[model samples]
Target: MLKHTDIWRAIDRLAAQHGFSASGLARRAGLDPTTFNKSKRTTSDGKLRWPSTESISKVLDATGASLSEFVTLVGDGTGTNPLQRVPVIGYAQAGSAGYFDDAGFPAGSGWDELLFPSLGDPHAYALEISGDSMEPVYRDGDTIIVSPAAQIRRNDRVVVRTRGGEVMAKQLIRETATKIELLSINHAHPDRSIPLSDVAWMARIIWASQ
Candidate 1:
């Protein structure tokens, strides 16, 4: 269960990590300066007040932080972890051979490294978006973090590799024993339904540096 204090503390730590005070974070998120003030955390009657989901969303977007990263902060509330160096590759290049292992985990050469907060997934890697196929949500040149270890569910944004060597990012629509359905991020692109046998591997996209 998520504790009220933990969530508030996470917000404070997130602000501090980005070199901002609580009020500054609120302002950066386009909220009133007092939105995250300590005094506002509780009512005059001492009733606990939780942050609104919209406020949290705005802060995350403003900070370029992932939901997973905020959840980690909720647990640790410590921004002490050192930046991690993770493998990175171009989205288009990911379709080429020798880049990923059979399970879709990054492998072989031609991968560069990037320093980012540890996402706690050993198989996590970054992909630089190349074309407008995923536009609006993930523009060209955006960096997206993918984790093969993360659990995939309906509607989760994911990176998928096919046995035929096609790699693409899309939202998972449905999956079953025989097929996987994907909804394109850009409406201009057509949604896809691939046989399970054609899918070499699929991984959930955990974060993106927009």
Candidate 2:
């Protein structure tokens, strides 16, 4: 039996595959930007709403995708969809309450998405650098992909959030069972050392788009 979720999720997957958000894809299809938004998935009375065939056809036309391809997407998005999807959030949002689980996976709803060619950890995510704090190597707007499941090593670029509410990116200087030393990417910023117990979580940065 074909579930409605399978079809819509396929559409979402299709939009993501093309590097477009659900809203962006809808706009490209000459439909309302919210055409595929999750908020519209259910009705005011909690009834499930499906995308109109007209809207679907429009999207197919806009992307030059044939019905056969659409069917493929439907099957692909169907729980069996074969792609590594990453959740994305801004640095500020990353600091916002309840955005990430203890292991650093996205825990909240409505996070933006990233489709990587491959990802080892399903929990891996990309955080957009917000300030020039990581200048020279990483600039504002650079997106760093972090994998919590990846092993953290000495001298690797990492994102660390402390229990006291400090979140920053620094090169790993050194680490021990009791403490961690970090080197600021910008020389202007001084190196920091903190007790490991004070750190909420730390993840190595695997990739960054400069």
Candidate 3:
């Protein structure tokens, strides 16, 4: 039996693979941004609101993705397609309060998930880099896996959380008794220096897909 919920989930997955939000995909398809939004799936009366064929055709045209691709994206076998699955959250929302708990596990809202090919690390979580700020080293769409419990050392690629709840990924340069210096992968980005006391936690980067 074909499930509407399953199709909805597949739409989300396909959007992520193309590095787009559901709204973003809708706009590209010349439809309203809410076309694929979660709220639009079922109404208050419990009636399913399937996407229109016109909207679907528009999406196909905009994405240049074929019907077979759409089927593969939503098919039952898709999850087993040799990709290492990791919990993914957007970098922009990662720094917000409560996004991660005191123990560094993902917490309250403003996050979405995705699966990627597995790296050897078992404790990996993917963070989508948002801007060109990381540039040559990490592009805007690049997704990086960070292991919170992994051993962190000077000169390692790391994801750092500040006392103020900001999260950033950089190359550790020098760790002194009082402060830590981090090198930005992009020459255009300035290096950062933070007092040891202001760092909440630091995690090691296990893998990254640019």
Candidate 4:
């Protein structure tokens, strides 16, 4: 007897509790910003649309909310979660001077601040996607959250910088003792294999605003 309205209401309440709008919540969960939009909740013919279980699972994981807590939200939509304000920069700017420290942590000036859901990574920063090089998966104007301190694993999406100041976002295919292989998100782009000695830094991408 789960009503569509009730489910959507719960999502709205959950976003508000975490200091986000519906779109922001969707982004934090690595989903399209319109996933929970009111305009997208029903078809033009007026057929109701329910939130997908996969989307729900991602949101719960991103917010660190338990299934029991979400069940309570579905019924009563009550609770409050914390928010964090993180440094923000453009992807292109990330390759420039004075933007980061030697360890790839946010540093120097020219950084804006954005209110985001707390992910518990003190070094987390936001990077705004700029071009079609990462299109389809991450379109232009999308914002991604990067954590320099997070552990990097195979197949994880990441942002990397080279000693020559080239910055790119790609999936980590593999990492050997001497080299790192990366798969580009855009099929048109070729994959990369860079020597470990030439990489200035590499950080995992934890979330993205589509």
Q: Which stretches of candidate 4 lie over 4 Å from their true place?
A: 1-80
lDDT of 4 by residue, 74-175 (tens): 543345534566898988889998788899998975578776545678789999999999987788887888999889999999999998899999999999
Give per-residue CA lDDT, model 1, range 1-210, as digits (tens).
234686798799899999999999999999999999989999999999888766787899999998658766765435454455679888888999988999888887656877655567777899999989998888888788898988999999999999999999999999999999999999999999999999999999876765
Q: Best to worst by lDDT, what's the order?
A: 1, 4, 2, 3
1-210 per-residue lDDT for model 3 (tens digits): 235765676677778888899999999889999999888998989898766545666777788886446655654554553334467888977788877777676775444555543344544678988988777667888777787877788789998899898788889999999999999877777899999999887888865544
Highest lDDT scorer = 1
- Model 4 earns a TM-score of 0.66
Candidate 2 lDDT (Cα, 0 to 1)? 0.80
Q: What residue pairs clash in candidate 2, if any at all?
A: none
Pairs that collide, model 4: none
* TM-score of decoy 1: 0.71
Report the C-alpha lDDT of model 2 over 1-210, residue by residue, as the tens digit: 234565688679779878899999999999999989998888999888767656777888888776546655755423563445678789998887788777767897777776653455778888999888898778888788888888888899899998866789999989988999999999988899999999999998876643
